[model samples]
Target: MELWERKLKECFGSAVVDKPKAINNEMPGLPRYVSEYLLGFFCEGEITKENLKETNDYIHEHRIDAREKEVFKKDLLLKGSLKLIDKFKVKINLTKKKEDTIQMEIPSLGISDAKVSSDILQSNDRLLIDGLWGMGEIVYNEDNKQIQLEKFKPFQLSEIDLEELIEMREQFSSDQWLNIMVSTVGLNYENYNRRQKLILLSRLIPMVENNIFMMEFGRPGTGKTYAYENISSYSRVISGSQVTEAQLFYNLTTKQDGLLVQYDVLLFDEIDKIKKTGIDEKVKNKLYQYLASGKFDRGEVEKVSECGIMMVGNLPPGGFSEEELLERLLHSSITHSAFLDRLAGVVPGWELESLKDRRKAYTKHYGFAADYFSEIIHKLRKKNYNYILNRISLEGTTIRDADAINKIISGMIKLVYPNGELTDEELKEIVDIAISYRQFVINQNFMINKDPELKRTISYLIYE
Candidate 1:
């Protein structure tokens, strides 16, 4: 009976009609707008001239202004349509003409010539973004913007932090602009705020050719898995205990029974739980090498896909002193420095603590559409990693000295940067997290190895 409902029935007939009905009858009721978006998505390419006319009439019946109707239609055509699936949501995109208006002189199968429409293919929010641009755009003028954009190229790297992101957004009011522009590009604003936006941006910015960045943190219930489970159609999560290298690197071709194919993100849950003893060292080494350099060979077809390797793990028990935890980890069978170095970023998971009050978890507004953030991330990956880092570091401290201390601190510094790029201020923050993590590790190690360097320094341990 609604505008989108009529349009959907006209375009897709009983199929979509059943969908909403089924939602009400068998599942939770979807918001009207969300349902309408799904209806538009279902009949995306299948829309015909007759259906369009019906849809136009339905829009008028619903008092949808011609201008607004045009905008929504434009979004539908350009950005594909929004679909709701179990747990996750998907936004598909159609090819778009990047202009304010699109003029078609040729006649379609039935439509007449001289058809003019607005060019609204993708959500402005989901527009192809270079993460470095967001950071540099906030700091320098337009001239420097171009300079930074050109200097950075997408690659495997980490990013800066949430507090600094808030500061940047505060300094320039670009957060509002981002919300406006990016939403028009096809993202939902309800799913993100500046803090989470920055965190997601940092994790995704340097992701480039054959890149793998793993984030394993101590915070247990901050909804890290929730985002991956519900967002972006391009990703999937696999339990570490169940995964095999074949599933990760390649799948089997059922017909010939060889490896099938690879994916964009191979997220391994409980990575710390995998059985390491039985697997051959050769296979382990190969897996490590592939993750580090992004290469593997099978006769003539050298499969080189831009796959991102993400592993999430919780820190050991808190009862052990920081030094004890580190010592226990060191005594473990894991051995591979290159893999450790390739860790582009490390999120402080413990920061995302579970609310002591269970009622806080019941709020409707707590969860966000992960795909929206994922799409934003997909766009940020277009920018250069190093360039973004340099631009951000302009105001922050630079680690000219990457001593063991510096190297340790750099990981935290990278978390606050746009793409592992830090400013002096960002460096200080990074230095703090690094020092904390290092202190934890060092104290634990002292108990295991009796090393003096493991002692926490007055400067390293920040006193409140």
Candidate 2:
């Protein structure tokens, strides 16, 4: 172990368990980026007998694989069960000759078909599985061998102890947590001010909000896409002037899930450049459906997704007001008033407004490693905090305005109070921040639709 690695471990705590290593590409089916982030030390580099001992510790250590993988099963006769996470296409068969069998396919591995018990299929639709995977050599291709199912256990977060989580969190002060949060996304926390922290946090909002639609348009160099691009394997950021419907939603030819289904955070960079003439009407409509219903239909497939959608683009350093941005979006981009109505919030990244920014030689604050932080957020997202919305007075607000407010509030609750415990002042702080973010959406919407009440709601949020 190196000195820097030791310091990183101490500062970040368990958030960065291991350093990044080169990814193993020979392993098919599993997402390599995810494996590298979560299990990089073991999965990276060449396979060796000495390193295989670490793999054998699966017996002693309780940690399990939590990403997609191409499991090359060695023995078809093994009966023991193992846990793993991956996408499997399932089908049912109830032939009297056997109890029952469910067919599963890992298309990425060229495993066209395999069988699992009905128990595995019970929580089938929620593909974010955490269960034991039984391994068997069921079939063989030209070079790669197909794996068989021995057993599986779908993972879920049961009831949590609020006190225990709070006790654990108590070790760090608010400043420490804030620094850790920023550092987790690969930035030095001390380098940013309070406004910059909000900008950085805006990137984490997707993990906090359920299918929240967010956008940040600013001058190109403001690091708008920095966190989204480097922070997590759960996110995918696509940049282009012309985005096709099949590419984003679904592919009709291959029947493959698009970016919406595959990633937790789906970012469309250079959204300002996505011209109306360059986009297909169907792609635009599918985006609308995804925004409106948290899912989209492509022929026979209707994917229920929890993806947080974000749009990013370049804006001038000055002279662009909310009203002007609304007009520009309508004329230059595929997004319309109907589409704009579905956004949960908008971030004003240009507000950071630093002319002479400098990077520190080393990080002063320790934060969660990108992989560890991603998992912490993944779990935090499961918490319920809708009750916090009751704290807000919704008088004279439209339904969309109220819903947007709740979405942002929900984000803050998860970010600040993941343990489901907080003081009234703490709660107010979260709500006030949530309001400030959602107010941008309300004000933007008002500019487009000319909603007077919506415009006033922004003022109310800032004043109240």
Compare the candidates by TM-score and give the number of the best one: 2
Candidate 1 global CA lDDT score: 0.36
TM-scores for all predictions: 0.46, 0.67
The lDDT per prediction is 0.36, 0.57
**Model 1: how far residue 175 lies from native, Å:** 8.9
Which parts of model 2 are misplaced by more than 4 Å? Answer: 1-13, 17-167, 275-278, 317-319, 329-335, 353-364, 451-455, 458-464
Write the residue-wise lDDT of candidate 2 on 145-247 in tens digits. 3345445432222233444444556555555556556655545556677657756676678865668888887776666776676555567778765677677
Model 2 whole-model lDDT (C-alpha atoms): 0.57
Model 1 misplaced regions, further than 4 Å: 1-210, 251-261, 275-283, 324-331, 336-339, 355-359, 362-369, 391-464
Per-residue lDDT tens digits for candidate 1, residues 1-464, read 43433433443232232322212221123222233333343334344456545544433333223345455434434544311121111122223344312222111111111221122212221112111101100011233221101111111112323333324333223344334322222233335655444444333322322354555445455455543443343455776545454544443331111111334565656654543433345445656666555676443445665666566665665533333332333224332333343454445454445434433432221111222334444444443343332332221211311223343333223323333433455455545544443344334444554555434442532221
